[model samples]
Target: MHIKPIKTEADHRAALARIDELWEAEPNTPEGDELEVLVTLVDAYEETHFPIDVPDPIEAIRFRMEQQGLEDKDLVAFLGQRSRVTEVMNRKRGLSITMIRKLHEGLKIPLECLVKEYQLVK
Candidate 1:
């Protein structure tokens, strides 16, 4: 096995190809051991080089609303009255714990994404 740290795009590509070849390698075998090491190296390289930023909290809420075919009225059940929903959506009001929990549970939005503090326009 000739494994190395994936330092460059070329190295990442090579590691990916090797991983594909070793996809079916049996565990505890030589090829399997190499596969595990290569996978770790590839993951590390991707985490550093291709990191994905979390979506904006309001954007995430809007996206989930669209995906679920939800309307303002639907949000009233989660957030409060229609006006409050509008306030929250428009960044005029902050999300309460109850609203956050509802969004997290009913919309399947990640709690971390929902809990992030966003700027409220004055």
Candidate 2:
């Protein structure tokens, strides 16, 4: 098993191809070990070169609300009042730190996701 650090795009591609070839490798075998190491290297390379942005805070909230089958009115418990929930959902108001904490605690949303900056409408 020839393994190396995934340092460049070409190296990343080659590692990916090898991982695909070893996709069905049985655990505790040489091929499986290679696959695991290549996956870790590819993940590290992607994290550095193709970092993903956190979702917009409002969008994350909306997505969670949808997943929970919740309505705007349901957000009052986390966001405060009906009007505030409307303002937040409409991007007419920015989320305060307190509100972010409440949303994170009450909805099980990640603090990072809830605290991401988003545009406010005029």
Candidate 3:
């Protein structure tokens, strides 16, 4: 099991091929141990090379709402009146801490996504 820091496109491709080969390795065995280490290295490399930022809070909320077949009115239970939901969704207002907590609890939106700073407009 030879693994190294994935520093370029070639290294990344090689690591991915190795990962595919190790995909079905059984746990607690020599091959499995190598697979685990390879996976960790791959994750670290991807985190550095292919970082993904969290989406804006309102976008996250709207996405979850769409996924759950919810609408603006449905958010009233968590975000208060329909107008407030509209304002929040339109990015005219920031999420209050209480609102953030409620949205997190009610919608299962991650706090990390919720807490990201975003412009009120655009």
Candidate 4:
């Protein structure tokens, strides 16, 4: 169990390779523990060096809609009337606090994903 902190791309790659080797290691054993720690180290390194941007608010809504097999009309309850739904989905309108809360609660979309800053057509 010679685990090392992943500080560079080389270290990250090595950790990933080790994780692959230990993928089937029995849990709670030495190899399994090493795999778990290496995964955490690699994840932290990637998060900082390869940070992922948050999805646009409208995109998040559309993704959630797709996941739930929903269409524009389905969002009318959370977004208001049919026209409002179209406007929001079309990026013609910004999502208000009320709409954010409703979407988060009703569609099970993460609040962090829904609250991301997004441009709206003037």
Off by over 4 Å in 3: none
How much does each candidate deviate from the true structure in C-alpha RMSD? 2.5, 1.5, 1.6, 1.0
In terms of TM-score, which candidate is strongest? Answer: 4
TM-score of model number 3: 0.89
Reference-based TM-score of each model: 0.76, 0.89, 0.89, 0.95
How far off is residue 105 in model 3, in Å? Answer: 1.7
lDDT of 1 by residue, 51-117 (tens): 9877767889999989989887888888999999999999989899999999899888998899888
Find the 10 residues in a row with the least total lDDT in model 3: 1-10
Against the reference, the lDDT scores of all candidates come to 0.90, 0.92, 0.89, 0.90
> Candidate 4 has what TM-score?
0.95
Q: Is candidate 1 or candidate 3 better by lDDT?
A: 1
lDDT per residue as tens, model 4, 49-70: 9999879888888888888899
Q: Please provide, for model 2 over 1-122, each residue's C-alpha lDDT reduced to its tens digit, 9 standing for 90 to 100.
A: 99999888899999999999999999889998998998999999999999998899999999999999999999998889999999999999999989998898888889889877788999
**TM-score-superior candidate, 1 or 4:** 4
Judged by whole-model lDDT over C-alpha atoms, candidate 2 comes out at 0.92
Candidate 4 wrong stretches, greater than 4 Å: none
Error at 82, model 2, angstroms? 1.4
* Candidate number that wins on TM-score, 1 or 3: 3
Per-residue CA lDDT of candidate 3, range 4-68, in tens? Answer: 77788898888788879888999998889988987888888889888998999988998999999
lDDT of 3 at 27: 99
- The Cα error of candidate 2 at residue 28, in Å, is 1.9
Stretches of candidate 2 off by over 4 Å are: none
